[model samples]
Target: MTVDVEDYFQVSAFEEHISRGSWDDLPCRVEQNVDRILEIFSDQGVKATFFYLGWVARRYPELVRRTRDEGHEIASHGWSHIRATEQTQEAFRQDVSRTKALLEDVTGDPVQGYRAASYSIGRNNLWALDVLQETGYRYSSSIYPIRHDLYGMPEAPRFAFYPVEGDLLEVPVTTLELAGQKFPCGGGGYFRLFPYHLSRWAIQRINQAEGQPAVFYFHPWEIDPDQPRQQNIGLKTRVRHYLNLKRTESRLKLLLKDFHWDRMDRVFLEPAPSP
Candidate 1:
């Protein structure tokens, strides 16, 4: 139940091309969608974690306050949608720092966790983890243990494991190897693209068979059917984002009933030390 609080157009690669004006022109439904999510979770009596973007935190400060007041953990997702791997160490540090401060200002609570945009921390960007630790973050859910054009570290562990050199924890998104390929079970585009039962079964199998909890994530915009369509983007990005837009919310509600879900902090116990 780790929710990424960002608008659809705010994805990193498209940030340079998309303007703030574009956002104003865009249909705004994230707040409404989240209200619906709140209702669903309330009905189920579940509390979850929300990793909020500073941009979203600033504009929708009440939403942040409401989310925290409702017993959900509010964490940081950086100031802008900048990916950790693409920025210098200082730049990434500043982004996350600003995010932490802004979120705390809005919620009046400390934000101890983070999730990089697009799960962008990887082998070459291991330096980012050191920066994260120094910036007072206790854990990061930013690594994906699958190969992807945008982000992943294929050799990374599939569950919560502390890095030896830093205090920061690495809780990678859920991935399952199928047909000789590691597929992301992080439940974003993959969840929408695949059949509903397959996604549910994957998490169930992981939890029951492997004794590991599935870390699920989705953006506010993903479930918003009224979001604007981007122009001039590549075909894959469009399809990955905009496909089956209308079905996302209903499907997510259905998926919610199938599992015993909780925040990542509560679900992941600290790993045992190696010999």
Candidate 2:
């Protein structure tokens, strides 16, 4: 399991509605929400990778330290919340490099994983993978294999695979294929949009039937139903962001109990046995 450590206002869906310039002035609830998440994970005895934004780390170093102290993995979610597709290669490099350095400085540990903002590193900009490797990351969970209006690389593999001929791994979020169609089972809006039982069933199928581990993710804002709602967003964005907010924490508890979850590095970056 992974948690995207960003605040609700930083969400890409609200970029148009909420300007980055105004981020500092807005109230931040990420610390409190993450505290709740940490409590849940501790109670369940699960360790997860937290892909934190540099912005959040700079503002809440204690939160990062607390998460690291509790045995969770700290990874980068870029310096700000800019999508990889939106950045030039140099800019993307700077973002990841700076964020990685900042996180490592805060935790005094080597950061080994990255997740692109909004899963924006698709076919057109897969050079981001090379940049990640260049920056010393071992793996990334940045691709969602299913097609969607916002982001996806539908042609990408449904499980962990090297995007290029290199050691750096690209782990796509989980999806269930049926009748040759891929449907997202990974966490995010889909986790809230679908019935909890449906998600449970799909994950079970992926585990038992396909013999593959599922890569699940959700944001810190997801469980905060009372977060300040954005105004003037279209009905679609409104529903996608706000639907079933109350159910996320409860459902997440069920998911933790229902399956075995570990840090992304532990689950996917384990060193191969030497011959």
Query: Which candidate has the top score in lDDT?
Result: 2
The lDDT values for all models are: 0.82, 0.94
Residue 29 of model 1 has an lDDT of: 72
Q: lDDT (0-100) at residue 225 of candidate 2? A: 92
lDDT of 1 at 205: 80
Give the TM-score (vs. native) of candidate 1: 0.92
lDDT of 1 by residue, 53-138 (tens): 88888989999999999899899988777788779988998999999999888888878899998888889888888888999888
lDDT of 2 by residue, 53-76 (tens): 999999999999999999999999
Off by over 4 Å in 1: 20-27, 178-180, 269-275
TM-score of each: 0.92, 0.98
Residue runs of model 2 more than 4 Å from their true location after superposition? 272-275
Identify the candidate with maximal TM-score: 2
